[model samples]
Target: MGRIGKTAAAALLVLALSACTGGTPDPASSPGPTAAPPATGAAPAAATDPAGQVSGEAVSLETGTDVGNGRPASSHDGLMVRRRMVIAVHPTPDADLGALRRQLDRVAAERGVLLSDISPDVLDPVVLEHVVPEVIVALPPEGTHEEADALAGLAFGPVGSFTGVEHVHVGSVLVHDLQFRIGSADPAALAETIASEGILSDALGNYSTSLDGGALTVGYTGPLLSDELVEAVREGMARGAGVGPGEVELAPRSATGEGVDLSAEPEPAETEGAHASGRDDSGH
Candidate 1:
């Protein structure tokens, strides 16, 4: 499938799973199996905040709504499933945190979205440096095209100017099973290989490959990231570096970012045969 097709399929799968599970997956931790709830005619339960306040934010659209036979609800169904998203704001010369929060709150209220949490340090240190003054927003999941459109309007509309937003990301989950570290010995070459190999590039929309603490760290945004893709990246990196597969390790990451653009084509230098000069100068 093409990149857009693959991304759409992954998004559909995530929404389906969300509908079945009754919520979006926790980005911080993996979920364990659970027993089926006892059959009851009771109305679906509403989410409760520890503070006992509704918080007036758009919760998950899928919350408290169930589709029969464990099937996901159709986009036409007006169910709102709460999902997480992160917005990275560029720092301005005279940035005011309070004013920014108020601006964000006003925007959320206008759009009926809940501004769950806002933090400046939620991003990886590497990503944090480039897109400092960031904030993570947890609002309703975009299960339907309408929801997605609303979000795009919010991100790219008026608020875009306020945050000086770098990007908006949805449904980003950090992988824990796969971990890898690049040593000081060859961090640049290794990072270059990982970026150019097409394995990691194919699965991620916006990503950062940088050296942190004398080791290479990679952070990316996308919903399609899977164990299989992780393994493929590991294997490809191993081959490129002439190292054992075990040498590649995945690192723990927190979710962050907004508006994953899967349609973006990788730079020519980051694609296969990028190193080759077009001319066959060698004498035939």
Candidate 2:
């Protein structure tokens, strides 16, 4: 009613990872509807928040199993205190690739949120099958569930206006990611610490960081990332010489950072080609 449910949002991550065609998306294309599988009481109840928008009940699922070996990782295996989610956008006919990217970039930057723009490329076959996305904003994790939801909602609040790139409501999927503010630490140095301490591995950990100005911007990774692995990395950063509680702060950007021009026709800015803030999933 209000928006898609949280569970459905998480479900979309699984759908995207599995349904990816690894080919470039056709902006004018759309996926044909799949008949909704019959619902059963046995099936999990529909996700309440930002969910139920999807037509059918999801009966079966697959995850970090065939992708790798060893104990399987469960998406709901833990509480999502830290979080990441994907916002899929269905563009209006007038929407151009660059316009969509700028719309999301300006809006997200205004909120100090980093974005990964999967435009003219990714097509989440399972959920947003009606319209091709001009941009999909990958929101990084906020330290707490309430915080994460608040940030996500705020970033997505200006969906169909402001910049004038209207995105018809499609679907938003919450992916797996655990993030912490690693204040003032050199990302490269902390990365080395994570490596030396064995915080990351092909098995379960991750080593991803981003920079804004000269400081390490909060990094995000998930769905495939392990909680234990991410936990170790957070600890490594927080335990540093003067680090304290590693929490997330959804603050706006400083004055030095470029501001978004909300007027429909904004003057040109730097190239966000396919990623906002010159950052992407790799934590550039």
Candidate 3:
């Protein structure tokens, strides 16, 4: 299968498994026309404009640094296995979308980057009033640092006549298949444990968790995925399931372009216990 098709198939498989296990449905699974909210959290009350649109400057996320202009810093390099760029554009209420799309197309073509998807901001209802637009672009894989840098430059750099660029994020796509062998444990409880631990929260990055049978698949895109972060997640899942940390297994795979593979067999997670005391050695 082609790249996009492969990615889609992998995602569908995960969804199908999630459905069988009675996991929460992904928003994408919902049918019919629906508006998409903001990619990040709610805009600060102080940052809202008269029209109820959050100012672009106020949407702060830890995913990518805000470099002046439309360009964000290069977030893909040797250390990163995969990367994707989410560019949130805040246009005027009456701005011409056709012209903006054309401008985006031109930029993508010029930079040789794939313009993956574009959608309206529906995550935040307030932002919907402003009709913010978000663009998703795929970056080069590992070993193509130069191409990744060029793409970042084009994205964050100036675009003709298109302004009000909110936030630009470039980060890794971290995918993991979590295996829990605990007997009769509730998936909901496990999910709540992971969420409450703040490992999958927006502060960590944009992430999703789906349960299929006894396995939980998590996908996140933002910043870097450190061993410490992964360990924390494992520990939380174990604690949530009422099992030892060693009982939970995590198999992780990262991608920079498109699609995710969640079918791969998971490996036993590292048992070194980076944060066994609920605190890093550095103490935050």
Candidate 4:
């Protein structure tokens, strides 16, 4: 129905699918998707879809950049299609996001994530009027999960303050050292809420859930959260890893072997655009 409603519905779709297949039980005991229980005597099939399409969860994938001479250079093909969301960043007036912009660009290239809009030149601008890009897949290269997580944490700084929105739970996920960790919110509960409860959805709808065993195992590299939210993060990570909330073992330190502050980072300068710089009027 609405933007927030759509996001919420998407979340429900994830949880419902998990329950139908007995994937993961909701921690809150909320009603989830319903499907006939797997036949008692039947062996689990090769986990194939009718069309023989393999599920992403069953496969371990690593996306790479294409430096091709034969193919065209556009964001429409390859890993770009796998993207599911977009984040547009613009700079504030009298403040240049040059450093931050470069960091994002480098992170995107390194992680297999894509950068949708805005250019390098506009990164150091005075204002960004209107710019929105669809997000999909990791941008940073492989082997930098923690770094990517930290960047995601910073990227979601603005939206993190909202009451019902646990920005990290729905934001970017990172892969690191072959271990899965929740990188966004400090308290894993926020992620848990996002995973367990359809905090963003409306009743009576069909959607998909992305938090299967496969989604949870993805690791992250990022900054720490406030002391208050760290435990939530631990719980959230455990859930993502399929450990369940009750079975989680939250250490004082993070899976990345570091600490984080839950307090929000200093607000990015207020500019006219999503990027730290004002929006660009020049036609590209």
Candidate 5:
């Protein structure tokens, strides 16, 4: 090619490059979307197994660190055990949860809902007060109905012992608060599908439901309700909702009775060497 022709071609190329580069975004300015807020349920995708053991929910409950331990249990065993109930308490309009908690404690004390009954692991009695004020009470497995009666009385009876409580939700396998974009599918329908259409299986009638704003949370109360089973239901719900795996933003699965924290599962001790020194396991 001639020198003048080559220079003109190079100039054209530079102009084309400049046009293409005009819309190039700065990496620092354009960041990827952050992960969804952590799930409170905290269970494996495969934990939907029907264990026939209703132990209640295990909460990977994450709340603010400001509010202190609400009358924690005396022993460490309390922290390790399963949650008997996830009683979500709704307070009166503009009421302070901290103050409501204090009032609930006093009322519970008076009603004989012992501090030990409520799981100490879940900030004791009141699990979540910041966003959704909730309470936890136990109807002991071996303990008589009288004890259960006492808990029910403290929460519901005596005509408002714990004042300022506007609403209450009782569940075992708590689906954590969820996040839904403006265009996200409605999860509220999942409850109707699960309840009316037979999704609970053996754990049916053992679970409870709670609706906070746009989020619908289902928790199990029966000891047979396992975290594995909860995950199954969630997956089923997603399928029913006509959404893909990650499309429907269901919260993490946590149960009351017995739960195997899939995230915290221990590695097999007998893994030996992942790869023998300098030796590839894959056939070359």
Candidate 6:
């Protein structure tokens, strides 16, 4: 019996060893579960282009109304072209303020423009707001007719803000950088010839200048300026000479002649007074 018991014990011991050694797995040999699938659809990183701003569309002046002769103007999308001019006027030889006023009066009568001679100190901010001229010709500096035309181009911006004004037109004419590129014989032809030689580099940008007998025609590459403003400037130029619309020309910075010179006109009386008072023309 002792032998039988011993034998049975030995068998049981063998079975225990087999179960421990053969049935259990080797963890090192077993493959691990796959990592969670890579996170899906990660967003792309932001990038920037070297050149911003797509090419801007050209503004068309042909579609709007004419505001020539102060007939009223129109509005436009922000894309409207705005031109501005500033001129300086100097006192005529004697430093006479009254003569300045008289000159302005005469100019106003002939050009149908309003003129006001406010005291230099009295030209307060409020009055300035009310008296925002399309062209602010500073007296005591003087300017020329060409300068006036450039100012006329810039005046379009101010007039564009007026209600009932449609399209684009020049608001004021500055007499700065005013050069008389006047031609003889056929006024229009002369104007055209001069414009052909100098308009691109002198007048507005990319605008073409032409002549039709005595009439001067100006065209831009893109669209017309403010209907009112452009017409105003054209008519203002035409008042002395004939001005009209021409073809649209393309080519940047094509206009020449450096800018206008408003100082070409006579200066105001206050200018001399300011200069005499040791204030230089700047203070008055």
Question: Evaluated with lDDT, which candidate comes out highest?
Answer: 1
Q: In model 3, what lDDT does residue 220 have?
A: 42
Q: Write the per-residue lDDT of candidate 4 for residues 1-284, one digit (tens) a residue.
A: 23222322111100000001112223343222111122222232222232344322311111111110111112211221111122233222332445445545664554456653311111111111222212222332332433333344333233222122111211222111122233333334435555465322222112222234423222222211122223444454455445665444322212323221212212223323332222121111
- Relative to the true structure, candidate 4 reaches a TM of 0.22
C-alpha local distance difference test of each model: 0.37, 0.34, 0.35, 0.27, 0.32, 0.26
| Alpha-carbon shift of residue 212 in model 3 (angstroms) | 0.6
Of candidates 4 and 3, the better by TM-score: 3
Candidate 1, 204: how far from true, in Å? 2.7
Candidate 2 global CA lDDT score: 0.34
Query: What would the per-residue lDDT of candidate 5 be over residues 20-50, giving only the tens digit for each residue?
Result: 0001122343211111123232231110112
- Rank by TM-score (best first): 1, 3, 2, 5, 4, 6
Cα distance off (Å), candidate 3, residue 24: 46
For model 1 the local lDDT of residue 66 reads 16
- Candidate number with greatest TM-score: 1
Each prediction's TM-score against the native? 0.37, 0.32, 0.35, 0.22, 0.28, 0.18
- Which of 5 and 6 is ahead in TM-score? 5
The per-residue C-alpha lDDT of model 6 at residue 122 equals: 15
RMSD of 6: 40.0
